[model samples]
Target: MIEIKGLHKYYGNHHVLKDINLDIGEPGIYAILGPNGSGKSTLLKSIIGLVNPRQGTISVNGISVAGTHAYRNEISYLPQIARFPDNLRVFELIRLIKEIRNEEADESELVNLFQVESDIRKRLRNLSGGTRQKVNMILGFLFDTPYLILDEPTISLDPVSLTKFRKIISEKKEQGKIIIYTTHIMNLVEELSDHIILLLEGRIIFKGGLKDIYGKTGSSSLENAISMLVDKNGK
Candidate 1:
């Protein structure tokens, strides 16, 4: 379970996350939806210990995230933007990550799934944006952790790759892992998310299942529902 209580965050004088509280105990896909600068990424980063909150606490599986590195080992995070050493090859980077984590990995399966086996020998700077995104996906999934966090995961993915990505995510969910992701793609959210957390101006305006959101907004599609929320909030 991921527990977040009274969380608050700030950047200089600007507050980002304010009095946030959530309990994600179920093993399913949870989509975090919000407009830009609504504190979605900040919230996710705080859970992963990449960002520090000014108040409150976050814990995963009863382990507190405050001032600890062990809790992070249970999480696999895919950031919105991934930067790697330009001189390193794809396989080298993968090997380096495995060594750093000092854990067994079956990245070869992911390489084959993403059709990036041939590109593994290529240098990082040589891969295209979409190809790099595929590599990023492989790296994120290689660890097979219980908690997965993805940010804009479909960026630069081709239709075929996107389909594969969805299948992989579904497979992980079937294994009873807790999955949380942030995406602007409503269709993907509608198709995969079992629950939704809608944030507005650093606060969660709505948090519930897809059916609940639809009922509240009186909209048939996820995109329109979110639009209604934004319009109602004057965002």
Candidate 2:
């Protein structure tokens, strides 16, 4: 389980996250939604121990994220943007990450899943944006961690790959792992998310299922509910 309490963060007089509190205990997909500067990335980084909060506590399972790096082994991250040396081939990057992390991986299976075999020998500079994203997906999913954090994961994906992505996400849910992701696609959220966390400015204004949002905002659809909520909050 992931638990957060009284979280606050700032950056040179700008408050990024405010007194945020949350709990994620179930095994399902949870979408974190808000506008561009709503602190979604900050919250995610905080949980992964990449960003520290001035005041608060974050714990995964029973381990605190304050000063420990071991807890991160339980999480696999798919960054929104990944930068790599253009000279490296696709497979070389995979091998390099596995060596750096010094953890067992099943990347061969993932490569097959994404049908990225032909491009494995191709250099990073040679791949298209969507193909590069496939490589990113393979690297992120191969670790088989209990917690997966994906930021803007579907960006630049082709339709066939997108379909495969959804299928794999559903499979992950069935395997009883918690998947946390951020995306602007409402239809994707409606299709995959078991719950959602909405942030306004630096605070979490809402956290619940789709039906709960509908009830709270008196709106019938997720898109309308979010629009109403953000507008009501003066965003």
**137-160: candidate 2 lDDT, tens digit per residue:** 988897878999998889999999
Error of 2 at 139 (Å): 1.0
Top-scoring candidate (TM-score): 1
Show pairs that collide, candidate 2.
none
Error of 2 at 43 (Å): 0.8
Stretches of candidate 2 off by over 4 Å are none
Worst 10 residues of 2 by lDDT: 104-113
Task: State the lDDT of candidate 1 residue by residue for 1-235, as single tens digits.
Answer: 9999999999998999989999999999999999998989899999999999999999888888998998777899999888889999999999998999889898878999899988999999999999999999998898979999998899999999999989999999999999999999999999999999999989898999999999998889889999899889863
Q: Give residue 157's error in model 1 in angstroms.
A: 0.4
